[model samples]
Structures are given as structure tokens and as C-alpha cells.
Target: MTTTDAAAAQSTAEEREALRQMAAEFTRREIAPHLQEWEDAGALPRELHVKAGRAGLLGVSFPEAVGGSGGDLLDTVALQEGMFSQGASSGLMSALFTNGIACPHIAAHGSSELVDRWVRPTLAGELIGSLGITEPGGGSDVGNIATTAVRDGEEWVINGSKTFITSGTRADFVTTAVRTGGPGAGGVSLIVVPTDTPGFSVDRKLAKMGWHSSDTAELSYVDVRVPVGNLVGDENAGFWYIAEQFVVERMALAIHGYGIAERSLELTVDYCRQRSTFGEPLIKRQVVRHKLVEMRRQVEAAKAYTHAVAAQYVAAGGPNEAVIAAACMAKETACNTATYVTDQAVQLHGGTGYMHGTEVERHYRDARLLPIGGGATEVLTDLAAKLLGYTR
Candidate 1:
């Protein structure tokens, strides 16, 4: 390679390392210590967001003009990888980074007033926000949202329920998907509703198999009224907006899949070296050695594929259906890797891996959610089939 090309490569590597280290440090210092307590509490402290915001960890990919740290999507990926490297659970990352999903639309297209009220505070860690998309019976059917938002002179009155909402238990507001017109995709609109509205309530906190620290909620909205100005972008354009953002969301899930798998592999390797059975360390056994190597291979493949697709996504400069299809494939690949790797990590760790306090155990539980959350693996595969023209 030419001298200048080598220099550019070195610079890029250094920049990526910097972002990674920043996230790792926060995980080690702030999250690792109190993680178990938060898990038991079933939620993270609101103060943690402020600390992360002050550390510039909360807004890595948002535009600086919108109170972000002026980084890009690659930066966000680097941050997530770093945290996972430091043993941060998927649940903790989801709870802390809820703003990543909640504030993007507002930052991109909400009126200045709405942005200031929701997006800025959220990125600043002064407020919590969640995206309300999935409902109890209407999972993955964005076009069939049953929640209705009717125009009432200067305001919109919303009535419906949202289920399986991340961070919903504590979010100050929600970016809700509501039906505003007819009975299809074109009639949906994204509206912001404050939690304090008399008719809006967090009905209950839901428990899950993993992500114990990230609080999920079943929310009910009964005639909740808000100004029409709170609508994100144009009326009945929410389906398009949600579709535009799916690539990034799927990429984030893909990152979680591989990131957790990578961490699991790392822990398992160390345990094998130190763990003894019969006459020698587990690493001395041929079968154990082969398992370790295969685990490493799968993790590497998943990581490389996801990162390549992410780079393509950034280079595209906007939403593209082909890229979205590729992202769905990436997510499935990584989730599959994570599932296999985490399960092996547990098996290699033997009885200890099954214990509740073990990190491998935590990952085993957390990794299960990736294939189900964001968009379920089954749903994404169907979507990809359609996107790729396998069906008419």
C-alpha cells in the first residue's frame, strides 16, 4: 500500500479505538459495579442517564445541532462493542440507550418546539423517552396500528394501548404510533405523549427472560390529548418514518447479538484456561479446544458481516430497500451466532454457567431477546423475502 493510504488506515483504526475505549470505560466504572442491584431492582437509576450524557456516551450518533456528540452510526456501533467487551449486559445497554431509539425521529423531523421538549432533553439524559410501536396483539404489523389519534381543534386526542415498550415504565414521554386516518399504513402518525397526562398510564411493568434491568411496560392511553404540534413529521407519514429507521434498529440488534456473543466467547476462553477437570485444565482437552475455536470463528464471522453491512448503510446516505434486506439478513446471522456461542459458553462453564450470578448466564438469557426484539427473526425473514422479490 502507498504511504498516505497506510497513514489513513492507521488514523481510522485509532479513531475507532478511541470511541471503543470511551464506552468501555463507562461500562467498567459506572455500570459493572451496580448492575446486579439494578437487575434486582428491575430498572436502572434515572441518574445513570445523566452520568452517561455528561460522558458523551448517550448521543454518539446524533447530530451535535440536536444535542448529540456529533458522531455517526459507526461511532454508535463502536460504543456498543466496547461496552459489551467490558461485560455490560444487553439489558443494561438497552435501558441506558433507549434515547437512541426514542429521539431519532424528533431530531430528524419534529418541529423545533417538539425537538426541544423531547429530543434534546432525552439526549442530554435529563429525561427518559421510549418508542411505542409494538402492541399486545399487533406485533410487527406497523400498518395495522389500532391506536387512534383524532384531531380535536388545536389538539389530537389519542386512545389506545402499547405493550412490550422498552423503558416505558420510566419514560417521561413516548413517541407513539397512532392511527390518524383510514385503516392502513398511510393513516398512521407518530405522536409524542407525556407520561403525566391524566389519561396516559404505565399500566404495568412486564418481566422477561432477559434484559432484567431494562424496564418494559404495558401502557394505556385513554383520551390523552396533546397539541398537534407534537406530531413527528407529517400526518399519516409514520409508517414511512418507521420503515426508514428500521435499518438502523436492525443493525443495533445485530450488534447486540454479536457483541454479547463476543463477550461470551471471551469469558468462556478464560474459564477454560483456568477451569480444571480430572487431571488438567479444560483447555487441555481436545474437544474443549475445538469448541473454543469454533466459537471464535462464528463470532468473527458475525461481527465482520454486521460491520460491513453497517458501513454500506452509512455510505448509502439514506434509506434503501436493498440495504434493509441485507440488514435483516445480518441481524439473523448475528442472532444465530449469539445463540450458539452463548449456549456453548454455558456448557463449557459447566454448573457455574447455569448459576444466576454468572456473566455467561446473563448473556445466555439476554441473547435470547435479540431474535425476538427490534423485529423478530421470523418477521424479518418474511420481510426480507418480500424485499428480495422472492414473493409477489
Candidate 2:
């Protein structure tokens, strides 16, 4: 490479390192200590979001005009990696950064009034926001959602329920997907639904096998009155927003999956060297050694693939159909890697790994949701195949 090219690359690397350090410091001080307690309690305190926002970690990729630091995708990835490396749980990240999913649609398509009302508070961490799309009957199938928003004078009367909504229990606002016209993707629309709206209520917080610190909810909308101005983009164009957001969401999930597993592997390696069995260190055994080696290999491979995909995504200027397929592949790879690594970490720790408070154990539990959430592995594989023209 030329001297100028090398200098620019170095500059970027330095900036990434600086951002990583900032995130690491914040994770160690703010998140690591209370993670177990928060998990046991099944939800993190809202103050965590305020702290993160004050630290400039919450708006890494957003525009500076929107209360962000004007960083790129690489900066966001670095922040995620640093948080996991410093012991922040995936659940904590999800709960604290729920705005990433919620505000993007509004920022991309909402009216100026809508943006000021919701986006500003969300970025400032004064208000919580969540994306609501998954319905009771329709899981990841965005096209066949049963929720409807019928026009009634100057307002839209919304009726239906959404399940598996991340941060739903605590969100001040929800960017909801509703069927505005006929069936299929063409009839979908996105709308900003405030929690205080009449007939909008959180039914119940859903219990999950993992991500305990992140509150998930089943929400009910019974004749919810939302202003017509709340519609995002054009009416009957919600599918495009959903598709765009899914790609970024999948990529973020992929990063969280692999990053957490990488941390688990690091902890396990240290334990193996320090903890002796049968008058020898665990690392002394060839089998245990090979296990650690394999864990490293898998995590490294997944990270590399995820990073490459993220680079491609930014290069392509946000997500499209092609990037969505790539994001799916990356998420699947990272999730599978996380599962493998966490299992190995647990085995290496033997009895302690099986305990509830153990980090590896927590990671094992958290990793379970990786494949099921975002988009299921089976669904993603099918989508990818269709995208790649494998279907007739």
C-alpha cells in the first residue's frame, strides 16, 4: 500500500482503539459488577442507559446532529467488542441500546415533528424506545402480520398484539408495524406508538431462557389512537423500513454473539491454567488444550467473517436485500460459534460452569437466544437460499 493509504489505515485503527478503551472502561465500572444481580432480578435499572448515553457510547453511529458522536460502523463494532471483552452481558447491551432498533426507523422516515418528539429524547437516554413488529401468530414472517391500523378521521385505530418485544416493558415509545392496507408487504406501514396512547398497554413481560436483564414483553393494542402524522415513510411502505432495520439488527446480534463467546473463551483459558486437577493444571491435558484451541479458532473465524460483512454493509451504504442475506449468514455463524465456545467453556470449568452465577454458565444461557431471536436459523437459511437464487 502507498504511504498515504497506510497512514489513513493507521489513523482509523487508532480511533477504533480509543473507542474500545472508552467502552471497556465504562463496562468495567458500570456493568460488570451488577450483571449477575440484574440477571437474577430479570431486568436492569434504567439508570444504566443514562450513564451509557452520558459516556457517548449510546450514539456511536448516529449523526452528530442527532446527539451522536458521528462515528462509523467500525466504531460501533469496536464499542460492542470492548463491552463484551470487559464483561458486559449481552442482555445489558440489549436493554441499554434498545434505542438502536427503535429510533432508526423514525430517523430515517419520520416527520420532523416526530423526530424531535421521539428521536431526541431517545438518544439523550431520557426516554426508552423499542421496535415492535413480531406478532403473536407471526414470528419473523413480516409479511403476514395480523396487526391492523384503520384510518378513522385524523387518527388511526390500531388493534392487535405484539410479542417478543425487546425493552417493551420500559419503553416510552414503540415503533410499531401495522397492516395499513391489504395483505402482503405492500400494505404494511410503520408508526410511532407512545406508551401513553389510549388503549396501548403492555400485557406482560415475557419470561425467557436467557437475556434476563433485557425485559421482553407481549404488548396489546386495543383501539389505540395514533395520529395520522405518526406514520413513518409513506403509508403502505413499512416493509422497506422493516427490511432495512433487520439487516442492521442481525449484524448487531452477530457481533454480540461472538463478542460474548470470545470473552468466555478468555475466562476459560485463564481458569484452565490456574485450576489444577489430579495434581496437574487443566491446560496440561491434551484434550483440554485442544478444546481451548478449538474455541479460539471458532471465535476468531466468526469474528473475521462478521467484520468482513460489516465492512461490506457500510460500503454498500446501509442494508438492502443482499446485505440482509449476508447479515443472516454472519449472525448464524456467530451464534453457532458462541454456542460451541460457551459449551466448551462450561465443560472446561466442570462443576463451577454449571452454577447459576458463573459467567460461562450465564453466557451459555444467553447464547441460547442468539439463534432463536433476531431470526431463527432455519428461517434465515431459507431466506438466504431464496436470495441466492436457489429456489425455482
TM-score of each: 0.97, 0.98
Question: lDDT scores for all predictions?
Answer: 0.92, 0.90
Candidate 1 regions exceeding 4 Å error are 1-10
Give candidate 1's whole-model lDDT: 0.92
Clashing pairs in 2: none
Model 2 ranges with Cα > 4 A deviation: none
Q: TM-score of predicted model 2? A: 0.98
Angstrom error of the Cα, residue 254, model 2: value is: 0.7
Best by lDDT: 1
lDDT of 2: 0.90
